[model samples]
Target chain A: MASTDINSTVETVFRIEQARLIAGLTRMLRDVGLAEELAQDALVTALSEWPASGVPDNPGAWLLAVAKRRAIDRLRRAKMQERKHAEIGRDLDEDRGDDVERRDAALDDDIGDDLLNLIFIACHPVLSPEARAALTLRLIAGLTISEIARAFLSTEPTIAQRITRAKKVLQESGVAYEAPRGEARVLRLASVLEVIYLIFNEGYAATAGDDLVRADLCGEARRLGRILIGVAPDEPEAFGLLALMEIQASRLKARVGADGEAIPLPEQNRAQWDRLLIRRGLEALARAEALGGADGAYALQAAIAACHAHTGRAEDTDWAHIARLYDRLGQIVPSPVIELNRAVAHSMAFGPEAGLALLAPLETEATLRGYLPLYAAKGDFLFRAGRYAEARAAFDKAAGLSRNTAERNFLLKRAAACGPARPVMR
Target chain B: MRVMVMVKATKDSEQGVMPSTELLEAMGKYNEELVKAGIMLSGDGLKPSSQGKRIAFDGPKRSVIDGPFAETRELVAGYWIWEVRDMAEAVEWAKRCPNPMPGPSELEIRPFYEMADFGEAATPEIAERFDRLREDAKKR
Candidate 1:
């Protein structure tokens, strides 16, 4: 193969293997920082050698073997350091000996705990939310620092530092390599789900990109959600999360118009929805409900999604039922966003004035003062109520606040369409 | 095992317009049929031309062109990644697809490359690695 072809193939292969390689090495080394470095070393070796000798027959195994060897070298170096410390009459931590034994036992079996632990650690509460997201994508998604930065629309250096600081914080804190136990387990699991959901939301509605969706990030998050379910089969919230994502992802294909402008849910063609995904989502929701998790936060969201997924046409949606679900969801995890969504549901279920009444109190709420969607929602309700000039002003405010080019243009178009004459509701 | 089913773009698609509710429901039902029959792995619709971009390369130099491309007929409005028994099966399923646009539209089926097509170069060992990778992927 040509050099460029070989390099590209190797890059693809590396992405597939890097997570496993790092996870395995972390099991042996008991250090996420060292494990990542060893994985990168293996990648560097592959880049330098593969072009000359052609790609290996079992490149993943080859990379794994190479990374394991690096682990052995590191163990030797650590042992030497310990010996020197002893010779100098300096005392090392008592846990050092036990760590070696645990690591040796880890090297003997194929277990998935390393990855599960890594997920928990990446979302550990010590790191900032943004840092946790960046680190999670880097370690679990096998995304490069630059790739993570690009996905989040941040600078590469900023992402690199975020990841570096995350690893440093993890190592310094001496975070355990096993999943948290008891009540802590529940909290950590929630964090893990939050990180994955955040990633998925970024893909589902890219905040600033020209494109309405970023399928790569969505696919990554879905894969991670499935893995979470596999690892934590008894966690009903995991199923709830998977259900919510699957149903939302099912609509991704139908969410955009031909010219790439964001199409409102009611305007999208229902036929374009992915039925398989919807089925999987419903099944997951059923699993969650079976586990008596119907009232859980994610399950509640999934219930809302079910309202949309079950309807064949937008007009046929059970608006009153959805409005009730939203009311319950708002009570459970009350936030400005949920309230905004609930307002939309109320408008659909009752009338535009009812929705506008709900929205009026939220206008001055500190948390949503600059939230573009709030204004956009208000604009829709006003336009439907035949308050044209007011709708135009709301749309203009929404247009000004939006960062996404397509969304901004769409809002501007709405602003322009707010003429004196009222259009008939469909 | 896999084929891409492309939805041909029309004038309305180029204009960044949305399909009607009736059309959306018809398409949704058709997609449900495909999903129920286990023919579709995944599918999605595309935004209009104005939201897309193309990169043309000349040697190492590349230039990016903003879309709203002039060629409406050549553009793709949507697509499905389908798994069918054969090309005949894929074609049969395509025939049952609902009209995705208000005006006449086209659906084209194209097969994906299989590992067997690589012949000698796709050694058993190489295939094994891919299988291992796929298995590992599930854990991520």
Candidate 2:
């Protein structure tokens, strides 16, 4: 590749690798800020050098090796300081090479509490869940503010401000860099898990863009979950959250077609489902269950996923069990979205009337006013019940409200299936 | 008395790889040194860009995207919250540290805004609610 190509490649890869690099650098520099600076220096080196050197086989490791050297240089300079002159002069008298060797040794310590702590720090309670999510996505996930904004059908400036303000608040509040433990950790873990899930959900059901899902987002969330498992192994909710993500992510491959069209859950091919993720999700679920996640929101969501995972086809789904789980989830974390999901399950468990009845109350909810899924789910129930005119109107409204191209297409198709619109009811 | 060190991440540091064992120890020692020196109030590193995401809001609508971002110069990789007497002390400590990056790195030190700085502009309700806001975050 030409130097230009090499530079571009380095930049692209850097986004993917930034978190790992910062994690590594923070250990050597002992300053989160310093570690980030060192990591940037590594990028600058690559930008200047890689054009001619070509990308290294292990580009990340190469950058890390380069960053650690810079840390050593600082140590040497500090050793020569006036305050350290007496001790440093004596130490320098022994061997200057020893200093280099020691610095090298210090740069490579590997038990990784720093990276784990970094997660908690990024997901700190000082910011809103959205703010924390944005910051984590920007700082830890290496996502651009615009890309994050696009994922949620949101605007770039708002996301950018959220991230900037979140950092400012964290700075102002004197939040610690280490992970919280004991009772405090419960709060921290919930935020962390929510951030991860939010990231995954965006990928799994992208709010905007042409595609229905962003596989990269799903993959990244799973990666974070696995890391969280290592960090907070005993936290059942952590495991539950991971399990939920893993199981849900397993369907990504089958959720769309070769043509990039949306494939509803009932229509998805189980054969395309990732068995590995299923296994992992089940394992994580087992851990959550063992740790007593019976009442946890994530665990309940995981249980709901399990219901889907256990069945071979959509027809085989245990809707009654899913309805119960949704009910439980709603009780713990009451939200319009949870209710919407439960209504779907109720429709599946009983019949269209049951689902429509469940959804009837949500019509008055202000928050669900612009929510497309509500109309789509209600439309599905109405369609099944041979209420074509009403279903057609719902689907049309869903098509109008949805931002996802694939989802919009699906809703439009459903509307078309419902036949001609003739003074349809709202 | 408190200052924050903002470290910018370049597109290069985010690789899906672990640092060598030696590097990890070196980092721990460096943190230990900072702690021993009393310059570090607290510090920690972040995960690679691949591990995070961003959420952009355009009014009530939200958008998200995966990371390992493109811009290196403007990106914030991590931060250190330090307790120091003043900017001079913060700079002095920053200068004493090893170079942050493998090639070369820069550290940007910024002071935290004091509550008093807000003066009468910030309502008491806003100030009191700040803590409550944080606690609310914990619940979500």
Candidate 3:
């Protein structure tokens, strides 16, 4: 291989190894920020040495060994500084030596646990959601500051500062560097799942961006979800979350029109849906169900998506089954969003009157007052019921509330289609 | 984006020879790593070309061709569709793959063309036309 190929190869290997290196180091040093720095130090060492020496047989192990040595050197220097300042006893040195040896012995073991602990720490509820996302991408995904910034559409320095502050908060709060147990484990796992889902949604549906979907964030979140499943294989909810993401990601292509407009599920070209992802998702959903997660929020949602996946033509969708699933889901999660979806499903399965009846209570809901989808759903039901004027008004309301250019255009078009031969009032 | 990584067929693969147990084990482990990393969407190995058939298309005519095909190097023994951040990431993962054959082999990585790649040409009308064509083809 040429010198440049070797250089690129070294960097690629480092990218693959960095997460494991940092996870193991954090377990040893008990400091995520310091572990990251030492990992970088090891990368630097490899860049200088590996090009000429050629890559090692086990590059990850090589990098870990180098980082461990640097960590020990740093610890020894810090202890020496403390000794010089306070004239500490020799027994302190002996205790430190034993501690180092013990940590070293435990380093190679429980690496999977170490990785899971690192993920839990990164997604700890104490940190702000943005900070948690930035930190997770940085520490767990081995993404650079610029990559994180590009992914989130933020500036490099802002992301760097966010990561820095998150690390400081983690250190000051003194979160344990180990996975929780029993009930605490369940709670912590929820937070981790929430962060991953949030990342996925941020990519799946950009809340505030010119781009409709940022596939990179979705890919990162899916990768993290898979890692979580690997480490916590017994957690049914983890499998559920992975299933949900995979099923949703499968439709990413069909979800948008060629003109960059959002296409409702019924209108999307089903041929574009990725069959492989759908199969993977269904398999994951089965796993979740086998693990007694059938009622889990993500599992239920994945099941609903599967209903659509099973049908080729839109008219062939099992709307009645979907409505039943949504009804069950609403009982478990109890969100207005679920209620709105249930209403739509009911309308499709039964009639527009049924949907309108279900949505009547939501009209008075303060949370749904400004929600664009509620009005859009109302407009569709009203249109189907032949109440053209009311449908037009509802679509107009939805169009007024929408911030996305494509969505607003779609709503405006719907509104125009509602009335007979009248000029649109913009 | 997504890329299809194809393991090119070697003479050994084209001869319908099965992989050794050790090679299969290594490939299985590598696949597990890919899944754990979450890049793999789907993957599978194909039977030898001898068991496959090909269709040839002309301007207005079609002909059927049976394999084993010539040019072993151009044949694909197996393939994986991986969603990656970029081509660089895809290359990194492909480099880590266990060699598919007992002898010299190659892995080719080609990215799928997304709708976005079409720029302004990907209007809804064109897309609908293509969809209609596909539906008609499926019916046939």
Best by DockQ: 3
How do the residues A1-426 of candidate 2 rate in per-residue lDDT, one tens digit apiece? 666656667776565457777865654443555666678888898888888777676676788777777766766776655655554334323422454664464345412354566777778887888887877777676767777787666789999888778767876787765546657867877888889988887777652234322535776677677667765567799889888987987886566554456666766666667676688788889999999876898889998998888887577788999999999999999999999999999999999999999999999999999888999998999999999999999999989998767778878999999989898665
Q: By lDDT, who's the top model here?
A: 3
Better of 2 and 3 by lDDT: 3
Per-residue alpha-carbon lDDT of candidate 3 for residues A46-159, written as tens digits (9 for 90 to 100): 989998898897888789888877876777777746744233223222322354564564453422466788999999999998999889988888778988887787899999
- What tens-digit string does per-residue lDDT give for candidate 3 at B20-76? 999999999999888777678788999989999999999889999999999999999
In CAPRI terms, model 1 is classed as incorrect
What's the TM-score of every candidate structure?
A: 0.65, 0.58, 0.88
DockQ of each: 0.03, 0.01, 0.42
| Candidate 3 clashes between residue pairs 3 or more apart in a chain or in different chains | none
TM-score of chain B of 2: 0.75
- Alpha-carbon lDDT of model 1: 0.78
Which 10-residue span in candidate 2 chain A carries the lowest summed lDDT?
A88-97
Q: Write the per-residue lDDT of candidate 1 for residues B14-120, one digit (tens) a residue.
A: 88788899989988888875654434567898999899999999999999999889878999999998755457557656766778888888998889774336555
Ranking by DockQ: 3, 1, 2
Chain A TM-scores of all predicted models: 0.81, 0.73, 0.89
